[model samples]
Target chain A: MTQTFEIAVIGATGTVGETLVQILEELAFPVGTLYLLAGSNSAGASVPFRGKNVRVREVDEFDFSKAQLAFFAAGPAVTLGFAPRATAAGCAVIDLSGALPAEQAPPVVPEANAHVLEGLQKPFQVSSPSPSATNLAVVLAPLRGLVDIQRVSVTANLAVSALGREAVSELARQTAELLNVRPLEPAFFDRQMAFNLLAQVGKPDAKGHTDLEKRLIHELRAVLDTPALKVSATCVQAPVFFGDSLTVSLQLAAPVDLAAVNRALEAAPGIELVEEGDYPTAVGDAVGQDVVYAGRIRAGVDDPAELNMWLTSDNVRKGAALNAVQLAQLLIKRLV
Target chain B: MTQTFEIAVIGATGTVGETLVQILEELAFPVGTLYLLAGSNSAGASVPFRGKNVRVREVDEFDFSKAQLAFFAAGPAVTLGFAPRATAAGCAVIDLSGALPAEQAPPVVPEANAHVLEGLQKPFQVSSPSPSATNLAVVLAPLRGLVDIQRVSVTANLAVSALGREAVSELARQTAELLNVRPLEPAFFDRQMAFNLLAQVGKPDAKGHTDLEKRLIHELRAVLDTPALKVSATCVQAPVFFGDSLTVSLQLAAPVDLAAVNRALEAAPGIELVEEGDYPTAVGDAVGQDVVYAGRIRAGVDDPAELNMWLTSDNVRKGAALNAVQLAQLLIKRLV
Candidate 1:
């Protein structure tokens, strides 16, 4: 007999949430019944599932006990408000927001730290890290044995789409306004977002580090299970719309063999290592892709012990939705 | 009496060359006569100088001995072919192209290595470092006194105009095609460069490092006078039409004081330090500006021995043309 579980997806109208629903359909997960829920403002929207329109209902009115699993894909406040209700109703929760503390819902990227799930109890809670951290974890997990990484410095060139649907539209609007030679009246972003790069993404704390950068550093360390690791991160808001491009440099304790690094990446799951001399770009290769594309892999120009590479991935799909769904697949096996 | 020199501008029709001509006018450089020279293809084109349109002539037919100083802003091949001729004619040379060897034309960033000019002989020759290196050198030169740096990692987000005027037009055309939903047939770039980031700028060598990256590392080391310093550089071509943004991380020998770092940056010439919280961008702050904008200065999240900063500058002016002009200003004092 085939056993299937009922599922609920919160924030179904969001960019990542919509992609999550689509990926659930594409992966053909054993979903007995799918419930799409959103806030009151978006309650009437309908999302397609199994070639049929599944109307979104208000989460305030939906009975959480009816669904065996719930995915929180909204902002931190929304997750903070509704996540407890779903967990109290004996439903497992997978949070895309970083609202829950690591000890309460340990961040998980299956490729890097699936073992963190073995000790979970019923009504399980887990977190999918930020796009930058998840993408890095997937690519770095395979290299754990090849090199002794002492420090990591990453510059994450983020896409505007990660902000939301509004940001995507704003980039288009700004680009159009510039191309047409119209005076730009900035709206979504505070300044010019077309053909420009913003050094900081969100507002920084008193320490001069944005929330996104702090989250990446903390989440990457946690997922890689190297809590004492030193990570220097900078998150820049690029003019890009859909994918993230990251340049990473690592300090190794000993000289690393380039050929061995290539072989490891080639054999790793959830990663596509580009061939030598050719590199990957967000639009040409990584958009809508399931795996993180790693390229330009080489040691430092003069220092043999240093490693540098470029990584690009579909932020909404592989970085967020797909990672959460992969966690769900693993969580279901132990769901009692 | 105001001393004036006869100046020859090679590649006068190029983006940098045209900008150099304008900057010379803005700075009110003493000039007896301005001679514009370009390749045979670009000859007959005119560039405006000091409220007059000066016609460009072919470099092959021009007499180098007629000018007291020559500025080479063309490609390396062009400089390699004509720089020797200019020097042989006893004309002091300032080359923007990285063609001449360091021993002959040492790389110079006026803010970092103005002292290198004091050692020069007659018919002085100097090379302006690449944009990434010049930008980094200007920002880091002020910090050499505050911190004992161990290693540096940089991710340079370069603008399209750095390649030339044709690359700028290609970016605009490709962007319009993408926005209009038309099928894109990439002409200037090998792939879709609109709303995308190319991981590598130029062709990489057998060791997987591109010429641009190597040039940045080499030129930066030379200008900083830190030959043993290890630098990891990744040059990514961005969608921006002008201005270059760089994210730099430095490993220090000991804990760094954030206040001292800020004070040092504030006092440095050729650099504008933004307010602590408010950051700078390439287009909003750096484009068409004479000074490099430095912002988001902070120590590492957990490691006090690490320093991180963001820098953006006008690649054509402050990075290349203005730096070259500044070198010429210094070199002419010793020209006999």
Candidate 2:
């Protein structure tokens, strides 16, 4: 049975939010009515949905009384301010931001922990894992089912497009200008973004973990339900436009068969298995894709307990927008 | 007193070869004469050495007898055919390919194992450590002095520029064309090189290790002198034009102070300690630089036995050319 939903997409003009509208329509989500909410700057701007243009209204002026679900694609500050108001008005909030604390709000990846969202009576918030974690989880899910994950080490090459629309534009403009031989300047980023890779993302905590790195550590533990699992991550920004790639190493408690592990990944949901010879999945290849493309799975030659793999995904889509919409679908199906 | 000698730079038109010429002039390596040798296509190409233009001569036409030290920056195939002839003719061959089997050659990283190059009876072939190994060695050198390394897990984000000039150009051209831009094609690589990261280098061996990865493991073991120590690595290409970055997690046999480790890194040779907040060393910043920029050195919160760090360097410089030149300098000093 298909039920119609009057959905309000908060932060509708942003990268992930824009993607949310497109993906929701593409997947044929039962949207009886669509409300596009954005900041004052983007208010009244129209976006295409289901082959029609929907006008974006200012969030401050929008009424959520009729919204069956409010998808918060806005930043933490806006989500914090408006989420409670939307929830109190009898609208279920599915937030993509990590504004709420992890323990109180259930962080979810549809493929990993969608079941947690099934019994929510109060307003539900869905926090998509950071890009690195999202890619890691997709690759690690099948491996964990086959091996006891004792340790995980990852190095991420993130794209500027993951920083949202402005940064993406900045990278593109700067790259074009630089190629045409112009003076390069750093704008959206603290340093020059074109033709370079930056290793740090987000502010570093006192414990020495960058915000992105910390999120990956905490979120992975929460999603995998392995609080004591040891993880080490290094996040780097590359010169690509939209997709992010990660090289991951896992230390298993027991020996795992490479063939079985490979087969499991191939059969998993939202995953595309690339053969051994195919790897370093490029940003252009993953830009519009929803599935996590993975390849170069190999067992450590000298160490039988270790396995290596590479994963790539469109950060704005599967890592954020698609993931949020998938969570909402799970909610609608009562599967989460 | 500095010894001046006529030097021949084989593969003079290649990436590392260009850097070799630049660094020799920058470091004031006493060059009485410079001979630029390359393939027939590059025969008329000119490279600047010591403030003068030196036209490239075909490898077959170069007079080896006039040169005292020949820097072989060419690929393995060229070195295999030419190096023996040069060495047999009484020229000191500094081979960068590192393809000579262990039984016949000695791998050298001046900072880690320079002693092997001293007092050579025959023409000594000084090989730079593979990019992955060289990077790992730079970070590990400081730590090894403080703790016993149990094992290491590394994921290298190797830039396409590391493949040499042709690959870099091809990547740039393909990337532009893929975006609906005009043809920027440069025929230096096997595939469309733009906006893509290729994970394969040096081809894969029978046992599934890339020739580059396998060589890195073997060279690292040999340089560290821990034949039994376990090391695992995954090398991936990033879209950046220069600079290779690595995320490393090392297991120590005994706990060590993170502060003390950072201090050691600051004092280490060929290493520049990047500030904690400064990471993701961009290609522009790392390019034309000789130092291995090390940053984000931290201990894993979940595991005290492990340490994580980000290391970046210009692959053409520190990873290949500069290291080769440094090896020659060390040999002259009798420190090798």
Model 2 error, position B298 (Å): 1.4
Could you give candidate 1's per-residue lDDT for residues B191-286 as a string of tens digits?
988899999888999989988899899999999999999999999999999999999999999999989999999999999999989988889999
Give, for candidate 1 chain B, the lowest lDDT window spanning 10 residues: B327-336
Give the backbone clash total of model 1. Answer: 0
What fraction of the reference interface contacts is present in each model, in order?
Answer: 0.93, 0.54
A1-336: candidate 2 lDDT, tens digit per residue: 767888999999998899999999999988889999999999989999977999999999878887878888888888898888887787778777777777656678878877778756665656777767777777777666688988888877787776788887888877777777788887888777776777777677775687777788888888887889888887777777778888788888876688999899988898988877656465535768888988778878677778887788888998888888887887766521
On lDDT, the leading prediction is: 1
**Predicted candidate 2 versus true structure: per-residue lDDT over B1-336, tens digit per residue:** 766877899999998899899999988987778899998888999998766899999998876878878888888898898888777777778887876775466667777777677645556566677766776776676566688888788877778777777677776667667655685554665554565555666566554568777777888888777788777887776667888888878888766588898889988898888777656474645676878888888888667778888888888888888888887787555422
Instruction: After the best TM-score superposition of candidate 2, give how far the Cα of residue A106 lies from its true spot, in angstroms.
Output: 1.5
Residue A84 of candidate 1: its Cα lDDT? Answer: 95
Candidate 1 local lDDT, A1-336, one digit each (tens): 667989999999999999999999999888999999999999999999999999999999989999999999988998999999999999999999888989989999999999999988888999999999999999999999889999999999999989999999999999999999999989999999999999888899998899899999999999999999999999999999999999999999999899999999999999999997899988899999999999999999989999999999999999999999999999999874
Best by DockQ, which number? Answer: 1
All candidates: TM-score: 0.99, 0.93
- Give stretches of model 2 more than 4 Å off: B1-3, B44-46, B61-67, B119-121, B175-180, B183-192, B333-336
C-alpha lDDT of residue B133 in model 1: 95
lDDT: worst 10-residue window of model 1 chain A: A327-336
lDDT, candidate 1, at A323: 97
